[model samples]
Target chain A: MPSRSLWVPFELGRPLGVPDDADFQIGVLKSLLGLFNRKSGPVIEDYPIESPVTAETDAAWSCTIPLPPLPDTTTPAEALKQALLQEVGSLAPWHAESMRRMGRTSFGLSGLTPESMPEVAAFLADVASGENPEPLSGLSEPLPIAIRYMADDAKAYYMEAANEQPGSDSPGGTRMWTWIYHETRMGQVFYDLRDRLASEYADRMAANGGERPPGPPPINPISARFAVRPEPTAP
Target chain B: MVRLKDLPKEYAEGLLNLPIPDYGPAPWTDAPDLKDARVAIISTAGIHRASDEKFAGGAADYRLIPGDLDFAELTMSHVSVNFDRSGFQQDPNLVFPLERLRELEASGEIGSVARWHYSFMGATDPSRMDETAPRVAKLLKEDGVNAVILIPV
Candidate 1:
């Protein structure tokens, strides 16, 4: 397939070289479209352009949205649920702004809506309490995306509510997401949930005498060759 | 400059191990002259018009993107978190290239842009794509497209 594909060395999630570079983008398009001119069985072309951003640079970047005190290890399930509900309520404005900018999100894979976020909060709180809640229903493409968006938005809302900054200058979705996924207590919770889920699946596979599914390699933050900065400790 | 093959071992394994259909070499078809051919684009970036249903779970589904639609009216709903979306956020042309195709049409580099383009969420189950591809090919044939450019994200 390499002979038939045009390869670009851009980061995951970005197929084009960079944001806001029309000339570079147009060049890529021209090069790709040029493939049709070949009367050959297979052809592979390497894009010459280099992306200015690197994983190191991206990893080093952090969001400044302040976060509340970390939920104590002994935090009750009901308390966590209450906090998540409040976070969702706080994110209403930001979510609305995102919708206005990007159009209504098409992510409703859990068959869950913002109106039913309490159900989601309850599920997460249960997971946090080390309870094996029922698996999310409708495990599909956009459903997982929708659930992620919900989790991200909840983290953003919690941070914003805890921040000293005025509401007039709230961070955008990307910044909030970067911060939530990379730093903060909520990020840890999300990561923990992911790890637990992976472990459970692996156990299930083992029980069924099936091989565990392949997944992306784990991040090695301590590697000297590709050192990613340590995440900030949650307050 | 890591290509898809260079992705983290686990990620690459997941994608590389996807069940791809065993397809043989297709007979080579010479492209019509660029200045006379009707060109169309098909992207596996999971793009859809705002009015269309979002793609879900390796769906064997596709959406039609009218040639005249605005980039702002398009959105991506793929599940993969591996690609950088900044370029797409800034200029959807990075993935869809609707505007670039339009420019080529205006410049006569291509005879015309197809009235409709197609999109499927890439990184989907290959079997689903295998099923959907022929249907999309039929649609392209109906639209009289002479050349196709496939972009994968």
Candidate 2:
């Protein structure tokens, strides 16, 4: 319990309502400061803007980047790798533009540069193919953890680049995530990884006499822990 | 904007079922006027400089962000993927609001901005912060921060 708590109805990621809207943000700030004047015990104020506009509520937004269609000439795993690399390559300029325009980015959680998106995508491709390749260097966490951050970095890179498209406004994370999971080959890779992780966990449990093991599990299943939404469609 | 009930059932249930710690009666005190208070932002977004250590799963530590540090240098490393990062990717002010705070300070809506801010990753057990909260409070007091606005992601 706080002496002055402001309960807002915004989404999980956006506590200040709208992005890039300074006036609205300032309004929220002032309302919070107004709580200091109550002259009472604990005060939990409901910020009057009950239904604030947010990225998730931006119905007019969509991804407009021209991602090339996936090539069908190679093995599925190889195709996934090539397709993701091409997508990353195609979005490079727009990501650069986004960086220049915003002067900041939310990438680099995996301790890799934006320039390393391709490497990260390739590694994910390997994961999607059920290969336990060596984890990328300079990662502070174990492979399972590093994979989650790398996947997030890859998503950020793509989304940030897509955000720089000229015509339509940027969609919120919900729409973008749906588009990524259902529409892109990268999404296919993620589905494959999720399935592989699930299979591996089952195998471990079977090896343990069909009983749960003690302590932390061998892997931090992204699907279980992170709860990636928009359940993967049938492969 | 999405309300608690609007979220998916499992996630919504998880949030609703989180254990709330009762720290006795909420501490009360008279606060200085908004025009005279020095404010600091205390975020649970796992934000830090890009080069700083990333928050491991359920790590019970916090990061210090100097007020003078470049906003561009800040990035979030929260372990949860349930929340949206696209908003933060486009405009960090959505989460950190450092720019908005600066604007308020410049316009005299607040007396001043604290010299330091802090962030601790959310989803970790709040009881784990008991030992560290006092140390952070001491630092905020040292920085003359009379008011703090806690933000969560």
DockQ of each: 0.34, 0.62
The native-contact fractions of the candidates, in order shown, are: 0.37, 0.69
Residue B82 lDDT (model 1): 42
Query: How do the residues A1-235 of candidate 2 rate in per-residue lDDT, one tens digit apiece?
Result: 3578787777668788777778888888788888987788578877778534445456666666555565786686786688788877888899989889878877777778888888888998898798888888876567777888888887888788887888876665566766667666677777777778768878878899999755455433243323454554333
Residue range A96-175, candidate 1, lDDT tens digits: 55546545333343444444545665665566556866656543334324445445334423443322234333232234
Docking class of 1: acceptable
Give me the candidate number with maximum DockQ.
2
Query: Model 1 segments beyond 4 Å from truth?
Result: A1-4, A56-60, A71-178, A195-234, B4-6, B13-20, B71-73, B79-91
The CA lDDT at A85 in model 1 is: 55
Report how far residue A3 has shifted in candidate 2, in Å: 1.8
Q: What is the lDDT of residue A99 in candidate 1?
A: 46
